[model samples]
Target chain A: MNMHTPLMSASPLVLSVEGLAKHFEMHHLNRTLFAFENVGFELREGEFILLKGENGAGKSTLLRTLYRSYLPRAGHAFYHTREGIIDLALAADVDIALLRRREIGFVTQFLQARPRVAAEELVAEPLRLAGTSYAQAIEEARRWLAAFGVKPELWAAYPSTFSGGEQQKVNLARALILPQRLLFLDEPTASLDRNARHALVSRLAELKAAGVAMIGVFHHPDDVADLIDREISLEVKTIADGENNVAE
Target chain B: MTPASSMNAALERQPPRLMLADPILTMTGIEKSFGDVRALRGVDVTVYPGEVLGIVGESGSGKSTLLRMMNLEDMPDRGEYHLALPGQEDLNLFTLDRFSRRMLRARHIGIVYQNPHLGLRMNNTSSGNVAERLLMAGERSFAVLRARAKESLDASEFPISRMDARPSELSGGMQQRVQLAKAIALEPALLLLDEPTTGLDVSVQALVLDTLKRLQRERRITMVIVSHDLGVIRTMADRVMVMRNGDVVEQGLADQIFQDPQHEYTQQLVHAKL
Candidate 1:
């Protein structure tokens, strides 16, 4: 058996992206944009991968494509679970809300435009979507926010009204509250200062210890030093030059 | 050069301490208290045009509060904040009327927040965020704003292609660079940066500092950058102000402040780091 076979049988990889590709028509350049081409990586159980790249280098684009905010024109993404390996690319689009609510959690730097749900409302969204009762969702929200180091006084405020740092914490709270297996962060530390960055890092480590696999696009190496287990570098050959095939 | 001059030169690699004939923003006997807790007491600073001033202090030392004072967001209960625009006008910012103060902040004062997202509009495109202050500054034409945004982004080496993506879709360094573009697009005479490079990685931090200095020189914009990284303060600050217990512990040129720190606190801070 190949090396991956046994490892998969024991502790399966939480997420894997193989030959992931997204091509968009860029009107400004009068050509199609290859956002990701043959981008291959595997995140084992509890593995933290820091996806590093500059702006326009497809960092946030890849995160969005992975979270299925935008559909990848071609290629594959899979989430390996106890049941079996589920094709994330298809699950991401077909069962978008359920997929996002059940297995995937994405924390954008600005938090997405999911509406100006109050602190309680937004935090409770995923679990409620997963069919949790309102009282249970609110209790979960309160507990998660406190666990994420957010103050109780700001619980009723809209995410739009909170400060950038506070809003990010709310995003983290919402994405992480449901105990999803795969977590994704795009520039999560962009708005956070040093102390807050440290606090989030420590919290992420705790979640990592609890067997949550995360894919993060990190800019500050120091802020992400202890969080990442692998680094992915992007070259033209990866996103422009096609090289690999999708694996089953 | 002789050995004496060589040693002297080695000791003082940069120029002597910053001395201006007149000050741009001066704080005298500024005292601020929050109920019973004294935040700032008898703190003073003298800032000049085209100068990079670094404010260094630890947590709870009221450095953040002092920066808030610069933006006039938080006012000192005692003392005066005298603002002078050389060759143009001189006025005490503390004495300005509400409309005058709003006008000054909207047009003259530009602040780069520690969290670029807080200062930037993330929902709109990058060009929209960049031209936001220009809209605030009464530049209403869409064409001119777009042109100005392109020019500012080009000047700072900001990736012009990302103009359509919202702040949510950019890297940390990219967002910070966008904030710089927004702040400098107005070409404000005074720029205040609060922990601008604290969270950035070392390489990105260097790039940001270089960009800050380059903009300060090209635009002749007076800068006050707050940071805890002494190396950052050393590289960018013309004059470094050390704050402790909500007061100015020491103030001098970067060389003097780093080499021979007079205050025990400053010396300790230096030793604690590198």
Candidate 2:
């Protein structure tokens, strides 16, 4: 892990995950799979940390656990918020929701949308939830969409039918619209073309400069080589040959 | 055969008076209170798989409170709340900690409220509201979650064309549909509906009830419905229990209760509905 000095004076701790572990039991098959074990990390403000792993190595699993999508079997993810430090792993639903709206954000590989919701409203949802005026939220959503090279004609169109790359742009636009203290990006650039990838990198650069902390997974290291301050690799646990195993 | 012999034979085939084919929930001596107000007192309820059990009473009669306790929304002051999910051992819900109870509820129990605002997120898109339940169950794939959301919305008869609209943007009936879609998306073993159709227009209420009945039969989901409207109970429930002053005054098969109420309170309720 790289412990680099911050560009700003006295940068605060943004997040820390301690002894994070997750395991799944397939009851029908009567076998257990250890996704990740004993993983620990700390992130300071404005640092971009890259997660590296091969398939089934639990890179995505770790990200999902930290984001509250999957409950970790063991661990504490402490996030520093305006209200003080909170363990996201144990945070109540309402508390997690408030933190998601104001302090944290996630941009995944694909965008999920209702069939009839237009792209503009989808991207503007976060801002509106944070008490932004409807008009201003729309204005900012359009600005980010334009920056990501989404066509104006598609602004009012539903993103569900958009091409993969187009949908990804809208996802990024929505996640980036708010100035989150910490962000998680899972393969965020996989569907983007060359130009769009570069645009995303530049936008990430701006966020890093603004003291945003990020933990990300990218298909290609070069896509975010300049921004990554540290790298962590996960290993996929496999059973030894001819070992007897049972989930219970 | 003589007439008395034939009647005895039919009685043997009838379902048990206080039991069911399979019991999903069995509670005993349940009691709850909010300071001075006794919400529930010494209540016992048994819910069967694929059966709609109606709990009818006026407000403060503990009908809604009983449903809330069963789903773990609020803990009873004292009592046993046991649940028997398919393929799983019987679980005493109150014995577990709050977090474990919450997790279990998310996976096996779903609850809908009378007011749309209580059950639906007013600002979230209908799809978002529906997908949130799946996300709570540890679903990580956005595609799969969204697809499940659409399926539940379709099952609830919500318009596919307006899936993206927020609750505020939809009509009251449409908003209730979104709430139903969200609850059913969990495929919960026990569905708790608290006055699900109370606030809607009579026509809209009928539409919502139709969708609910269709889904109930298609999914074979066990349900406990609490309603002040006796008509709603008559239309949806297979078994009926009447509550007064936080106690069950009468309980029986829906047909029997409708045709012949045994208690004065139940008689008054039946008369009022008529």
Candidate 3:
């Protein structure tokens, strides 16, 4: 077990999660599958925490739960917003939606490209949604695409036709286009080539300098070892394990 | 000088623009039934100007029924419908009589169906079909109608060489373009599409949808599209409403629906597509 003490920072706390847990009930099998339990962490502005675990250890599930893509069974993920602190696990749908619009961003492994929308537009969409003019947004998208080593000619092509690496580059460009206060990245570099991976790391470095809080899972921990403030390793809990393990 | 601070500054400098402007169409508590079957339950929708709102669901989801109500092709059993077109901001669609409704639809609304035969006259030339819509909008003078018809056909990317060909003579893709030319000829404020590219070849579907997207952007026409094809909805809509068994399961910005669907039914639909 590799555990490091949390880094002391002066920056404001962005997220503080406690006793978070999630489980899925399989109706047909009459089984309760516990994805993860007793997961907790704290992240401050500009801090990067790397999530580590073996396969089926629920790292992705924990990230999704923090992002509110999956509902949690217990505990609180208290996020600090300009309005005030709110429990993400219990936040209203509309409230979560508002946060997603301006403060939160998540990048998964696969690119779910909309049919007929080009790569450039896909990258520019977040900025456009936030009210940037078409000209400016497209210009910014091109800049990001070029930096990520996507060929200029392919910028206008649909990402569905691209290779896995190429599509992941487009995905990264789109997700990182907008400056988010808190970002969740799940295996973002898994499909990236070395050049694109370097570009992504540099971009992430910039985000950290600007005080953007982030929690991410990476296949190669050494690539981001220098940037990580700490690591949170999740242990898999099997069905054979008793459910009454919570502290009284 | 950190990238994060710069990024935050850049975001701050952006002008605050509201995602939705004044709604061009608003329907409240819309209900409809066919004999013993309830096609639609109490539902409401508000469509903003210059935005594409997509309605999606499986067959018999009442998506088509709700769309028909918007186009005035079918009357809802109970609902309050309002149009915010110029000089008619306060117009209530239900209050209008049949003839008045027809005239209103002709002047302000355009619809494109999945089957070109439903929207086009197979006997008429492509230009003639387009001109017919212009003629109904009360335009006179053969010279003006002829020029406008050609312009609209060109806007839809219909081949100038096929301008005089009947719909039956054209390929399926070309026929769909002709229908598009006819629907958009009147420059209607609101355009409603029912599975606009459902039957075309994949390549042809892309072309047709591209033409529609260009026209929409150039003209800034508000659009309401109903399609069982999730890809079509994902491509064109700024907002999406998911329907299931006569109820709205979820509705939100397109990204929200596709990326982080909250409703169980919506998640199933999205996952099935993936």
User: Which has the greatest lDDT?
Assistant: 3
Query: How many pairs of residues collide in each model?
Result: 0, 0, 2
Pick by TM-score: which candidate is best?
3
Give a tens-digit lDDT track for model 2, residues A55-149.
78888878877876554557778888866788776664334444665788888877765455679988897787677888999999999899899
Candidate with top DockQ is 3
Compose the digit string of candidate 2's lDDT tens values, residues B142-253.
Answer: 8998899999999999989899999999988998899888988988989999999988999898888877876774566889999999988888887788898898876655
Docking quality category of candidate 3 according to DockQ thresholds: incorrect
List, residue by residue over B195-271, the lDDT tens digit for candidate 1: 98878887787677767765654465888888877887887776788888888766655644674454556667876
Which of 1 and 2 is the better model by lDDT?
2
| lDDT by residue for model 3 (B1-274), tens | 2323322332232123223256689999988888988888998887877778899999999998898888898898998889887787787798789999999888888999888888899999999999998998899999999899999889989998889999999999998888888888888878999998998999999888888877765576889999999999988887789998887767766765786554557767888898
TM-score of 1: 0.48
* Regions of candidate 2 where Cα sits further than 4 Å from its true position: A1-3, A6-9, A240-248, B1-274
Candidate 1: segments with Cα more than 4 A from true spot: A1-248, B1-20, B86-90
Candidate achieving higher lDDT, 1 or 3: 3
Q: How accurately is candidate 2 docked according to DockQ?
A: 0.01
Clashing pairs in 1: none
